[model samples]
Target: MEKDRLVRFVGKVMEESGFKVYKDFKTSRYIIDIYGVLPTIVGDMGVVVACKNYDEHWEVGLDVLKEMEMIGKTLKASKIVVITTSYFTNSASNYAGRRNIKLIDKDGLVTIAKKFSKKENEIYETNVIDENEDSETYIPSTKSSKGPSIFHAGKRSLSKSGRSKSVGRNLNLGNFMQGFKGIMSNTVALIIIVLLLSSLITYIIGLFNKNTALIGVSKILSSAILSYGLVFYADRDPNVVLTKGTIVFFVSMIIYVVLIVLL
Candidate 1:
């Protein structure tokens, strides 16, 4: 019952992604739930899908996946996509590899479903995929480019917004470094000046206790300046920025501030 729901869910995702769903197709040995077109194909080519609930199994065994692979190969499936509620074991992965079968676990199923769904939804291009172009994108081969854009909305080109919208993105170690480089390039001198100015302001606040409000406001400005400056410098630099380093720097700075207060 639950497995049927999961299968339906996967089907819905696949449908949304623009793949045509032909469900409940019987093969020689097994009944396949969802068979759909790959993102790169138009007209006739399609991929096979085998959906499983996996209530009892913790992992997909090699035998089950291999059987499905054989069936798919017999059906002339370009790829055998197995969507299971359970993940595949290491042995299962190896088995699939030996047979050139593609496996999608629960998590992987969701991802592939989403990806295919997104491709299917290119309302802009409803024509058959160009064989040469689509083949290059869909098939798993070393000849493909590192960042080949296919099954995208239209005109496989990167937009400026896509390229430049890294400001608020959650970055990894390498990405953080890239962002830090950009940040540094944009605001290095400004940060240094702000740091010096903040130090001077701190010195002034210490000496002048006359106007508490004025001192408080100055302190806030100094802190903001210092913080913004540092962040800007880190982001603008075209290189020399690490995500971990930035996080550590801020965390340490916060600790240092707390220590200063205690002292």
Candidate 2:
């Protein structure tokens, strides 16, 4: 079969399976042969598909699967599928299994084609697949037994919102913990923490003593130190660190003057 024909066939199958199918869907990085979306009560599930029209001697490899996986991720698709006129390599099959990508070989294609013809009340003939070959479709195993619910609108909404809030909190906590761990391991970050603490203490003492000059000096010093520490810690050029430090010092002095005048 030709590549265009294969893509059309796959799009038809997806449409029959209740997907809103789009052919030759274009993304920022790729032009997907087929894209489908299955709308449910909870949310819309997207599927990214690629079609390969290879001869029997040629087989799809792991690289193709990896590319399809990337396209799926870029589109945030719920499923990834690669349908081919030939078979797949062992490595490709294994990788697809691990990545939850669906691989449909020539035999599987024949099976779906037959079904599609039967549905359309038309005769479909193809010499691409062997008649004796066993038809097997590979569907990745999913943990959920009960799929998305269409009923219980109120209850589902409540449960979905609760899960979203829980996930958000857990993600925030995880990010905070990771950032704290990174800061603890970095020497420059430690120095910056110390400088900030010392500056706060000095500012408090200066305020108690009514020493405006001391407060202004402490603020300027801390701001410059903080900026320099950040630039150095980020592994920037020395020249960039110096430039940013000087700019931050002057900016801090200007802010101090404006604040003093306003107060």
Candidate 1 lDDT (Cα, whole model)? Answer: 0.53
Per-residue CA lDDT of model 1 for 1-263, tens digit only, reads: 38778767666665544456778877767777877653331223455777778864677787777677667657756456776777888998876665435677777655655555544453223333334346544443221111211112222324323322331131122233433433333333334444466658867786867586776567556656465545544333223234433443454456546766999
* Model 2 pairs in collision: none
Q: What is each predicted model's overall lDDT from 0 to 1?
A: 0.53, 0.62
Error of 2 at 113 (Å): 0.8
TM-score of each candidate structure, all chains considered together: 0.41, 0.47
User: Which has the greatest lDDT?
Assistant: 2
Regions of candidate 2 where Cα sits further than 4 Å from its true position: 122-263
Ten-residue stretch with the least lDDT total in model 2: 144-153
RMSD score of candidate 1 (Å): 18.3
lDDT of 1 at 69: 62
